[model samples]
Target: MRITRGLADIVIDSLCRGVFAGDCRRLSLRSCFPFLYDAECSKRSVVLGMVAGGDKTPHPDSPLIQRSKKEKWSQWSLRGGMQTLSEALESYIKDKGVEIHKDTPVEALERRADGRWQIKLPDGSVTADHMISAVPAAEMSRLLTPIAKPMASTLREMSASTVAVVNLEYDGEVLPVSGFGHLIPSFEDRAMLGIVYDSLAFPEHNRRSSSSTRLTVMLGGAWFESSVGDPDAVSKETLLSLASEAAATQLGVKEKPRRAIVTLNKSCIPQYTLGHWKRIDHLFSYIHQHSLPLSLIGASYQGVSVNDCIYNAKKAVQRLTGS
Candidate 1:
């Protein structure tokens, strides 16, 4: 059950920091790794839980399980890009009579005396019997402050990490080695979090006319303020320079990129800091006590991965519809 300092550091750097974008000391194990936490709680030992609690027998009717038996798990990507998934979802919902209001930010949220939810937009307001909030924790907090101060306070306390993504494309392959990418630990004292070898992993995404290499460098997580300075003040040129330096030092890439792009995502990844589970429990208790129809979902409450969001969304719908 006990691990040496060396092994502990490796796990903290590779698993905790890689996934949560936060240090293991700050991240809540229960919130970030619920399965492992739950297993430890029930089995009284993490190792035992891992060995004994696994799904030993696959269900015969499960298509996914059966397919996995035949095909080994491998990395995959969409044809066009991640944006394609969003476009497809929008099209499907539009066909299903879902009216989407783009670029219309909600200014305020109010609970009507008739037990309905009213959302105030710039132009007008709309009311609904139930509401599912998928916004970030801080934004949700601002909207709920007038109605539920306590819940808003709790939500406001949840912190998020800003990330800068720098994409570089070279005319020819520049990487010395071929693999997914590498993650840098906090101990390395580097501003970069990791790098993704996009061209290698998803060759279909590359330009068909020419052989090119694409790389995505991720910068600034929990240490953004200390390492990279203000996310807003940092220029694209600086990020690109840093990305280039990182590539040159780590991957032996010295060639200038043919094309480059830098994007700053402010407060993108929610940090499930210590006591996150307790805070969420309190939020749910408050919602129950007030009989509020508001349901919270997304990276702030549960898991952060795309799969996690989809699964949670489905569960939320089932709960709301009594299915």
Candidate 2:
């Protein structure tokens, strides 16, 4: 069905900015929402495509897909925040004899003549039969420039958005509503992208009294550099002020927060703009053509969610193990 310009402006634009944190006009429907694009390509109708697609067989090895067959999927959070998940994974892997090196910055990556991957570190270098890069696109591009200039150049072209998270804890409940907060449309021209009701979703994670409320204000996305200026130069105090002002104006939150924290994540979210899929396809083709023992994973290439990363990582492992 053809979407009217009015509807597109009202809904599609808002959704694109909210989900991808980028402008819909600039983002590729094929890259950002492949399901919709695939449906249109194959069935000529998105609705029909979705129906046909759902009838297809699910991957046998996918635990998530299997779980969905028996029960509905639900959003969940760890008891001690997201860090708990990382810690748990670390513990489980440690038991399996995986040697994890923390705080060791990799200076460069070199492909040895023996077809092994050499990782240069501050102290020494380590060689491996295979290498999986999970770093951001820019960093990955920088590291791969010497070995794979063409692929690195392609990676360098991919853009990302910065986000500033301002966490505020008030003495008493301040939110006017009780759900997952709200997202501001790009048309709104607000500094804040959205606000997440942290305590409302996971009350157990609250460190303050039961009566208190915790809010996480998300600022900056595609408009960060243009509107807010340099992220590094922006002060935490300024961010806190912005959060407070947003809270007061939007949610009618006037009370001063007992505690506030500001965190600037530079280029945290990748923008899958037009031709993103083509770029990815080219990168994979290059890898295969060069017979490189390297694999790429993480938010830069595909899905950005934690579940997406885990699913992709599992698929990569299966491929490497010939499972």
lDDT of 1 by residue, 166-244 (tens): 9999997778889888788777854888888999888889998988999999888888888998887999899899999
Candidate 1: residue 191 lDDT (0-100): 81
Q: Candidate 2, which segments miss by more than 4 Å at Cα?
A: 51-74
In Å, residue 179's CA in model 1 sits off its true spot by 1.6
Indicate the worst ten consecutive residues by lDDT in candidate 2: 54-63
Evaluated at residue 50, the lDDT of candidate 2 is 86
The number of the candidate with the highest TM-score is 1
What ranges in model 1 sit over 4 Å off?
A: 42-44, 54-70
Per-structure clash totals for the candidates: 0, 0
Residue range 1-323, candidate 2, lDDT tens digits: 35688867767777776776788889888888877887777788877888888234234455766776668544567777789888999999999999888889889999888999899999899989999888888999999999999999999999998888899999877788898777887777546788888888878787653588899998888888776768989988888898998889989999999999899998988999999999999999999999989889999998877877887887788889999
TM-score of 1: 0.93
Candidate RMSDs in order? 2.5, 2.3
lDDT at 278 for candidate 2? Answer: 91
Distance (Å) between predicted and true CA of 75, model 2?
A: 2.2
What local distance difference test score does each model get?
0.84, 0.84
